[model samples]
Each structure stands twice: as C-alpha cells, then as structure tokens.
Target: MRISFSKREHDLLERIRSGDEKAMERIYNEYRNEFIGWGVENHSISEQDALDHYQDTITIFFEKVMNGTLQEIESSVKTYLFGIGKNRILQQFQKENTRLRHEEGVHEHYRFLAEKELNDIYTSAIEKTAGMFSLLGEKCKEILKLFYFDKKSMTEIASVMNFKSEGVARTSKKRCLEKIREEMTKERNGG
Candidate 1:
C-alpha cells in the first residue's frame, strides 16, 4: 500500500528507502522486545501474535518509505511502531470478544433447553400431586393451600381456620401431609 513517508526523520527514512537491511534490523532489535512487553502488559496478546504484528508494522513502515507514500516521518519511528502494535492488539481483542459472544449464545441455547426440560418435569409432578390432592377433604385442602401454596404461617392458618391454637393448625397440617405421603407411596409402589 502507498504511504507518504515524512521528511522530518529523513536519516532513518533514507536508510529505509535505500532498502538497507541493517536499518530495518536495527529498528526491529530496538523495539521488538519493548513492543512485545507492552503487548503483554496492556493488551494481553499472545507472544506469537505480538511477534507477527510487530513484523507487519515494520513491513508497513518500509512500504511507506519505499513507495514514497509518506512524505515525511511526522512521528518518531518508535511512536509509529507502537501505534501499529496498539491497533493490532485491539484487533485481536475484538476477535476474541466476538468468539466468546458466539460461545455464550450457544451455551445459552443449551441452557434454555435444559431449564425447560427441568420445568416440564416439575410441572408434571405438580399436575400429578394436584390430581391426588383432589381426593382430600375440604378442610384438608384449605389447610394445605393456606400453609403451603399461600405460604401462610401456622399462626395465620389458625386465625383463618378458627383453630383453637397454632399447635392445632400444625398438627392438622402434619396429619394431612402424612396421608398425602402415604397415597404417593402406595401409588409409586403400586400397592
């Protein structure tokens, strides 16, 4: 790609323009480690990715010089290299984020299916219990509904049902639960 090499840093620019391998090597050696370190600390980019990015940055720098796209080096070589590293690091992060989002969406789909299956199991169990509960006496049904379904306290059930005391309400609820348990057991055991 065409780049306008700036004239401000002509010495290094001229070296690069002449296809001087030493000049390129010097730049690579000078900043490669520093760039990689920065990549690790700031961007969390892998070492290999950092290496590849740095090389691409250098390549772009030379292309800018050779093609005369860069009229001058408006910024220092180090600054330009660092800018390229930052851009490449950002690209890596964006790609990683996109991948994670896709995985999360797939997991969400599976999780939704799992939760729906569990809910269906619970709903079936409730329906079965409701069918059996229909056989309970009116008093038993009222006590169970007030205590369990409505989440009423023993004292509240005693007040509503006009039980002699909270103890009576508790006793009645316990007896009703025991009867339901017996029926459930008999049904399951096919007695």
Candidate 2:
C-alpha cells in the first residue's frame, strides 16, 4: 500500500517508532473525535460503539506499525483508519445477525416450555384452592359460587341469598374470600 504520507505524518511515525508515547497520544487525540463523529454520522452507529471501534482501530494500527506488518497504506492515514473501523463495525453486525438466527428456534422452544410450566403451576394452585373451597360451610360455598362462578351482581346475590341488602351480600362475599385466603395461608404454612 502506498500512503501519501505528509512530512508531519512521517515525523510522527518516526517519533512513535522511537518509543515516544507523547507522539502516540498526540495522534490519538488528534483524530479521536473526528473518527467518532464520522462513524456516527455515516454508519448510524452509537457514540459508544463508535468510540469502541475507534479504540480498536487505533490499537490495530499501533500494533501493525510497531510490528512492521503495515509498512505502507494505499491512502491517507485517516482514510486507512476509517476503513479499518468500518470493516470492524460491519463484522460485528454480521456476527450479531448470525447469532440471532441461531437463537431464534431455541428462544421459541424455551418460550413454549415456559408457558406450559406456568399453566401447570396455575392448574395445581387452582386444584388446591378448590380442595380447600369444598371444606367451607354450604352457605359460604353457595355465596362464593354465585358471586364468582356465576358472576352474579351484589343485588342479585342479596335477593337470592335472602340478605337484607346489596351491601350485606358484598360484606358476606368479602368475608368468604378472607376465610379462603386464611385457609390457603394456613395450608402454605403446613398447618
């Protein structure tokens, strides 16, 4: 690769080669923001992604220069660096796409198993509640079945159960529910 390396760039490269850390830092600061902005504006990458890619790009460039692998470039240093960053970003996207494709079936299968397990738990809890429910007094059972299973209004329940008013039926339903809750709690506590 042939880089139209400027005299300043040549000097910078020489300084870096001579183990000048300040020269490397200077080069890093010089292009960091520009690279990030370019990545965001042109590639639609997040700022953090751009920053990370830029760091990687800089690292790769430093390694190549230090190890004598990248002897020359076919363009300007900025262009070369951007090219590396773009390739890395595209590679990441490709990897994410491949991962999603592989995970789709696994995800669906797990979701199905999760739903089945939830349903089984719900059925078990309902069966337990029903068992406890049968042990209640006939009056309590009738009132609960009418209000819950039959979806009867408070006024309707009051009329059916011969309560004084809708308010009395409401209170009775509340008390029945409280009794069921207490029973369930006792059962849970191994009583």
Best by lDDT: 2
- Clash totals, every prediction: 13, 0
Candidate 1 lDDT tens digits, 1-191:
44444454567677876678888787778899998888777877788777877887777677766656664544677887798768767766334544346446655776653577665644444545578788888999989977765567999899999999999999999998787767656766898
- Relative to the unseen true structure, what is the C-alpha lDDT of residue 174 in candidate 1, on a scale of 0 to 100? 91
The worst-scoring run of ten residues by lDDT in candidate 1 lies at 93-102
For each candidate, give its TM-score against the true structure. Answer: 0.43, 0.47
Q: How close to the true structure is residue 11 of candidate 2, measured as C-alpha lDDT?
A: 82
How far is 61's C-alpha from truth in model 2 (Å)? 0.3
| C-alpha lDDT score of every prediction, in listed order | 0.73, 0.77
RMSD of 1: 27.7
Candidate 1 positional error at 75, Å: 1.9
